[model samples]
Target chain A: MIEFKAAAVTAPDSGVSILEPTTLTLTEERISIIGANGSGKSTLARLINGLVLPITGTVEVDGLDTVKQGAKVRRKVGYLFTDPTSQLIMPTAVEDVTLSLRRIIDDKSERTEAALTALEEIGLGGKGDVSVNALSGGQRQLLALAGVLAVTPEVIVADEPTTLLDLRWRAHVGALLRTLPLQVIEVTHDLDAASRAHRTIVIDSGAVAFDGDPAEAVKFYRDLMFGRPTRTADA
Target chain B: MISLLGIYRPGTTPLHKASAGLKSLMLLLTVIVTMMVDDPVTSVGIMCACLLLLVSTAPPAKATLRAMGIIMVVAVLTVSFQLWRGEVERAIDVAADLTAIAALALAISCSTPMESMLDLVSRMVRPFGRILPPETIGLMFALTLRAIPEAARIFIDARTAARARGLERDPRAVLIPGATRTVGFALQLGQALHARGIAEEAKPERTEKKPRRDRRSEKAAAKEHAAAQATADAETSETPLVTYSTTKPANDVAGPTTAPEGNTSAS
Candidate 1:
């Protein structure tokens, strides 16, 4: 379980506070964060992975303090960025996934085998040898996920993982995420994706304005985003 | 304009098919030979052979000439410098040797793609075992090749933007922001690397033993077969799919009635 206690995060230059002092515990199996632009949803996700340390207060993942044991915490909490292009460090798909397994699988043959298996799991079995720069946006995102899952982290935090994808791929990636055993925390602007999560937290002005069932949270977010009371539970 | 070094022109010429290790080795050997053979005839012969090999690869002649022009200018400067120092014979020999070396280097680059070069390096370093991850090094090379051009483009764009804002005269307006933006890009890249599980801490050792099968040879054959199949498929497809075509225009054709009259007219 991950817990953020009175976490307040600020941008490096602007001195603008992104996440206000707020304590939140993510004990559920699947949690979705919903917010408008500048509501600090991404910042909150970054905080979980130690990508952004809190200016005040503390964040702990599985009792591992983020500030003191950031690298350890990050090992447990795998992060997926919005852009796969940015995430893919290697030139080829297989090579990219193989990088993650390098520490875990000591033998050269085992690493290749594990990487291939991970690619096959993501429906990209034959693409291990292909250059990463040539992959389609959807394929790249899936490959990125394959790379992340190769590490076998306990918590998976994705920041708008499917934001750049088309409808078909967005659904494909979302479905894959739903099946993962790891505790998944996703920050998304997509209302439909938020609705599917077990719990949802809506952030407004750097604070949690609403937190409860996915349906209620979605309603609150829609109302806040569109400046009108959205029909509850269905829309 | 995109430089020859940056742009990749696809082809299946013999030069393209040559192993990167062989090409690199040949390039190095030629350079050494050029330096060793100070005789003018030997130098000129090596340069001609390099040029011929480069030409046979079928790269844009303009690119070859441009590279040659740069080399020649440098050679001339070196020769002039030697002459100024009262070393006439040394100047001619040095200039000739330098020309041969430059010609040979350009030929190698023209013949081999960046990815192939990286693959060769990776393969060459595999025997060393865990000192440096070949894949990581290859990826670094690819990223460097890709990012250098991108960073340059970004700098140009930033300069243009700064100039438009009437801050062109201020050095800080250009250099500071450009540096900041580049650093920001690098940070994003680093974060992206971390997110994808390719962080330094995540380097996994090669667990599998090398198979008896010649894997590199198999890979090359497989790539060729795939390319052949793709080309055949492209030829067979009746309606050529313009892969980059956006949804809006294609939508217009699929559902003519849905598009507004003005939009359809504009198209």
Candidate 2:
């Protein structure tokens, strides 16, 4: 479980609050956060993993304080970025996965074997040795996911992971994320995907505008973005 | 330039089979030998041998030729500069030596897979493990190989966007965006590293030597390391594999966005 106790983030330069003093506990297996481009949804997702530390209060993952036990919290919470190109640091697919395994597996050949197995599991078996640059955008995203999974992170916090993918890839990756057994908290603009989550949180102008059933949260997000009264869900 | 790096092809040729460390040493020796000799004939002979070795590996023809073309262009410029100075023999010697070294470097890169080369780099740095983490240094080298093509793509995209806006001739249009985007990409990469927690655990050990912790604390640290390793072993039993099935071939019709020379996939 991830907990935010009056946690809020402020922009370092301007001292403007990026997230309002928000206190919430995220325990659902599949939770989606939807908001406008700059509504602080990404900030909220990042707080779960200590990527963005709160200036006001504290954020904790499974009782481990994100600020104090940051490395440990980060180990438990894997982050997936919008663009896999930036996330993939190695030349080849297998090499990239092996890099993630470095902290876990010390033996060279055993690490390679684990990485290859990860690639196989992610449907990139034959392309393990291929240059990461050569893989299609979709495959690259999948490979990035594979690297994150190789660490066996307990929670996955994805920040608009499918934003750069096509419709087909978005659906494929979305379904894949939903099926994963671990807790997944995703920040996305895809309303349909947001609606599929077990719970949805809607952020509007750096505050949680709505938090409830997925369908209702999606409706609230739509109303807020389209400049309509957010009471449409109630109406 | 990106193609000049990380372009390895798997093969059974003697050069391919040679250990990356041996190949790297040979490359260094060949360059040193070439530099020690100012005779045009010997340099030319070395250059020919390097070319023979490179072609025997049968690397991608287009990419190899492109690299050779670049080497030839540089050689010509150097030779012409020497000729302009009324040093004809010096021109021949300098051009031949330059070609020989460049060809030899390319040959080594083509024959040795990048993973092996990275391993060789880490092994080389193992002696200085206290001061610098061998794994981190290896990661830095791998990141360089990975970033070159990405940087090239960013430049091309920036230029294309500038051209579409009728600002192709304006250097600032491309340079400004390219610089900012590269910085942004680098920041994202750092975040990725932190999130992945690759080297975070071992980071403090490098600094522990400077602080000179007490023997008891050192023992405690050793115990912590062992516990971490034990936890890692326990976790390895759970593969953490997330499997999925796709409907169609995942291959993109647009092919790789990078240049053909950048592919270098074992064929």
Chain B TM-score for each model?
0.63, 0.72
Report DockQ per prediction, comma-separated. 0.09, 0.20
Off by over 4 Å in 2: A232-235, B81-92, B204-267
**In candidate 2, residue B225 scores what lDDT?**
54
Q: Cα miss at B83, model 2 (Å)?
A: 5.4
Per-residue error (Å), model 1, residue B134: 12
DockQ, candidate no. 1: 0.09
lDDT of 2 by residue, B146-175 (tens): 777777878899999999999999999999
Model 1: per-residue lDDT, tens digit, B149-254? 4577668888898899998888777788788887777788888765544535534332323233444545555555555555676888753433322212221222
DockQ of 2: 0.20
* Cα lDDT, all candidates: 0.76, 0.82
lDDT of 2 by residue, A1-235 (tens): 8888888888989989899988898899999999888999999998888878888788889998777778888889999999998899887788889889988998888999999999998889988877787889989999999999999999999999999999899988998899888999999999998999999999878888888899988877777878887573321
On the 0 to 100 scale, the lDDT of residue A113 in model 2 is 94
